[model samples]
Target: MDRPSVRRLPRGRHALPPERVARAQRDRLMTAMAEVMSEKGYVKTSVEDVLKRAVISRQSYYQHFTSKLDCFMAAFQRSTALLERQIVEAAAGAGGPVERFDRAVTCFLETLVSDPATARLCVTEVYAAGPEALEHRTAFQQRLGDHVADILEAGTEAGRFTCRLIVAATATMVSGPLLQGDHDALRSLGPRLVAHVRDLKAAGLL
Candidate 1:
């Protein structure tokens, strides 16, 4: 008689464990931190505020993160990752380099528009968090800049767009505006922004 074969589990499907529970709790706290920070600003948002919103104990919170800033950084990083994934996937499916660039621009704007509070936190409160948060923000910008450069370089090489300026500098310009809290204003800026990126000299992009 032969031994029975074990069935394979699907991707991302596995038995729950203590680590998973801990992660879930941490995610809840981060989400709550975003909401509370948006409402009260980072300086005013206490650990108790997050605890109340997350429905977790103070001990549970400390178990996952060292402090409020730590939790905020985790939330910022997670949100940034999600935005990057959406933009990349959208750009990848487009027909050509220019189209990919346009799709990425749209996705980037929409991500901020869909969540004004998160946008506000990133723009205004993140710097106020502390030195560590500022360092994280700089690193985040560097990573995003590299991604933007890859897209622009592809388009430039394909002769679909002109990129005379430094790629990193241009990417930083593209990212700076999306941090605004006013969705209505940002929506209006999208068309002009795209046009400016394409025709950089026309808009004094340098």
Candidate 2:
């Protein structure tokens, strides 16, 4: 009798270990959701679209996220974490308070321009999602403000800056335009934004 012919698994069909498979599925779903949300606003994108894009079934999708909004929230949180890392890295090793603030602003604006989808989702969609979404956004904003306030407090103690306005002003300066969604306006104000940060340093108000 002829030796039994060996069979090969189809391309991209090789079995993955259970943990790897689960991780891969989660990643795929997140990526698909982001793409869908970016192309169509959060309100327009649906769970079915996410499943189709991810090529995962409804059962698999539910296993990962309770709802489409939940998935968007998770994606938004991940984006923010990445953005905060970038801002911190960009500001690291700066010689002065002004330089550090400038680096942070530059990193933030560059991130917005480089990833407009993230900007849109963060700047626009979250608020549009309604009260619960706004509550989540407010929490994030407060955390960021607190972090900036800490930086400002440090600069003041070191005599690198000297003003009580640092906390609220810095928070507003960084987040105001991002919430406005006017790309042209932001671009026009880019130089002014840097100058304002520098002016704060000069006035010891950082």
Candidate 3:
């Protein structure tokens, strides 16, 4: 999705606090990085791409990030953190394991579809950034799998593997349709994924 533009400060000094100015600038930079990386992929994106998209100066980019990889990794961290948090909350509160699992699966799919730019980076572009980025992505998926294992009260190795497998698979399912420009098909994935989860559970995989 296209984020609203960052409101620029006046050409000269303004009343905004230095900290607030810095925060807004950083938001612009990260948002821009997500946008650029999604469109161009990690290997193809450049510092200049982000600079132009963010309307922030090259010097400003350096102050916040050592390089494009650094910025993209930071963005990856931010996006995955939020996704995990949302999933946790969705699985929280008054519900049985089944209900909580449903909520989580639904929320996870919805969040990705709702934010295509960030989803593209987290799901696909990370593979292009080499081992570190892939490790971070895999590790987060592992944690998310463990969390789901806790939700399902299935902390066994088989359970963990199944949960993580489905999580990773679901993400791939999304990236395929998204890359193909089939967003309607992508949005329709939740029910199908949940159905597959049910099959997995029935097979004693969860």
| Best-fitting candidate, scored by lDDT | 3
lDDT of 2: 0.64
lDDT of each: 0.66, 0.64, 0.81
lDDT string for model 1 (108-206, tens) is 667667775566555557878988888877676656655655665533432322332333343445344545355666565556655665675344332
Name the lDDT value of residue 101 in candidate 2: 62
Q: In candidate 2, which residue pairs clash?
A: 162-204
> Which residue pairs clash in candidate 1?
none
For model 3, how does the per-residue alpha-carbon lDDT over 86-198 read when each residue is reduced to its tens digit? 89998999887767888888887677777878888888888999898999999998899888888877746888877777777877777888777676787688777767777
State in Å the error of residue 5, model 1: 39
Q: Relative to the unseen true structure, what is the C-alpha lDDT of residue 171 in candidate 3, on a scale of 0 to 100?
A: 72
Model 1 clash number: 0
Candidate 2, residues 1-206, lDDT tens digits: the string is 01111122234767767677676677677667766776887889999998888788899888889998877787677677777677767767836655676676677677676666676666567866778767876666655555544544445544332332443354455455655555665565556766765776577665
* Higher-lDDT candidate of 2 and 3: 3
Candidate 2, residue 114: CA error in Å? 1.6
